[model samples]
Target: MKEIVAVLGPGSWGTALSMVLDENQHEVRLWGVDSKQIAEINTEHTNKNYLPETQLSDGIVGYTDLEKAITGATYILFVVPTKAIRSVAKQVAALLDGKTKPVLIHASKGLEQETHKRISVIIEEEISSDLHDGLVVLSGPSHAEEVAKKDITTITAASGTDEIAKKVQKLFINHYFRVYTNSDVIGVELGAALKNIIAVGAGALHGLGYGDNAKAALMTRGLAEISRLGVAFGADPLTFIGLSGVGDLIVTGTSIHSRNWRAGNLLGKKVPLAEVLESMGMVVEGVQTTKAAYELAQQKGIEMPITEAIYRVLYEDADIDEVIRDLMMRDRKAE
Candidate 1:
């Protein structure tokens, strides 16, 4: 009933997950690239930079050395940013070197910018199959700030194999945290990655001072856009209506805690993209994800007008007002 888990990344999400594992009575080896953060977690039991005002459990130990962190660990949860997934996974491959086969689970959401591959796909590409059990993705509307404070949250653990999904479900389920399993890995991953784009749009609408009516329209149509692209990529349409799709879109788009939404809010306020990102002090995944989704939509011949509009404003020098006007002036169609 006990598992030794290696959590790669010591950010808010990673620390919050470590707390969940500690609550579930698992020995968590929390790994981080920052030596100061690791020392703080080890000595003070606090990750102040990320999760302020929270004390971590003694069952969770911090490790700076990647090799030392994962040694003899049964489960490796990759909670790093989307961009860091590949490099960290490569490190896992070089260090593990056929020593132990642990179940690989990733909580990071987003597709690689150029390749447009899901986080799970990128991990599988970097880490050999022999080094771990089949992959599982954990995702939903859950936010690190809420989860860190013991708020009730539900998320989906998806894998190609139901057995693997169930294994992950049991590992994180507890009083405040609930985990559900889904077999649609493609749908789940796409929903997880693509929702951030929609969230950015929602934040932009908010920043522009649009009220409930406009926000409702954006979220509704955003789901339509997400569903269209997701179906083209062979994902189940039903998955979009579920937690990882609509659920994640709702929370991330509306919550101030969401970096993607915050970034979009700043952009809507006419703040420069570079300044917004620099001020956030965190990875605004939606910014990069919008580019990837725009490219993917073009490649797949899927029409995603909202994503296109956001992409233009972020990547191109297009004005947000002009982009919104162009979106409204598009050819009329039945919804």
Candidate 2:
């Protein structure tokens, strides 16, 4: 059963996922803002800037025209940055007017800054119910770099209904790529977003010459905070131990392929956030997520020490060393 799939955003993750669909024998339309990049992808079968040294399948086509990309697609995969989700969804919603509704699937992971809405909520707010059939999220420890090379990877496809989740699971699951279905959308999304904050802390510890023992401790404690905040927001605590939770936290925190980890590594070396952003030339989602999470925690009266410390480093220009010392000096408590 071949279908048309529209994947928005030409970042590494989006491009890699497009390849997966292509391999699955589906028609894939990859949409990007830059005409030049689209041209490069279509003409050269490669996205040099994002997935360097990887060749995209010829079955995948790149499009700059939003309407043309999704006009007749049966599935829409949103992979843009969290900050851009709302604007992009609005455009897609307009394009979807008077057309058959498509299954809406998003792989982006982050919460809205001030509003603190999950990605699905943001999309639902902008896109009319008449124009979309369902909302599903794909998340896990999978990295684009590895997935591009056909390395083994597993992820979760979560939606309100089992039918929707299973639809996505079927489209993506194949040899070397496994998909699991879950009904806990809130937990899955939170696990995907919150883990990046911890990953930043993990990278900072590494940049500051911390050993595996310290990194392990940071990740363990980070999961606890993530679960606490997630539970406060109606997410299942058990989801934290699953792929989207601990699984995502482990890879994002430790892998050099993670943009968030790389950003934190630079910050650990005392690099300015602006400079780090300029150098990376990609979205460091964790930086913004830290602010949103910190605000949300304060508003909800949830105690998240690591998130608070990372927020101070990112927003308040607090010294990383001093923040670390303060975190260490906090009164001891049972785990």
Could you say which candidate leads in lDDT?
2
Tens-digit lDDT track of model 1 for 39-79: 99989999988878898887899999999999888899999
Q: Report the lDDT tens digits of candidate 2 across residue range 190-228.
A: 999999999899989988889999899999999999999
Quantify all predictions' global Cα lDDT against the true fold.
0.91, 0.94
TM-score of every candidate relative to the true structure: 0.98, 0.99
Residue runs of model 2 more than 4 Å from their true location after superposition: none
Model 2, residue 289: distance off in Å is 0.1
Question: Where does candidate 1 clash, by residue pair?
Answer: none
Model 1 misplaced stretches (Cα beyond 4 Å): none
Q: For candidate 2, list the clashing residue pairs, or say none.
A: none
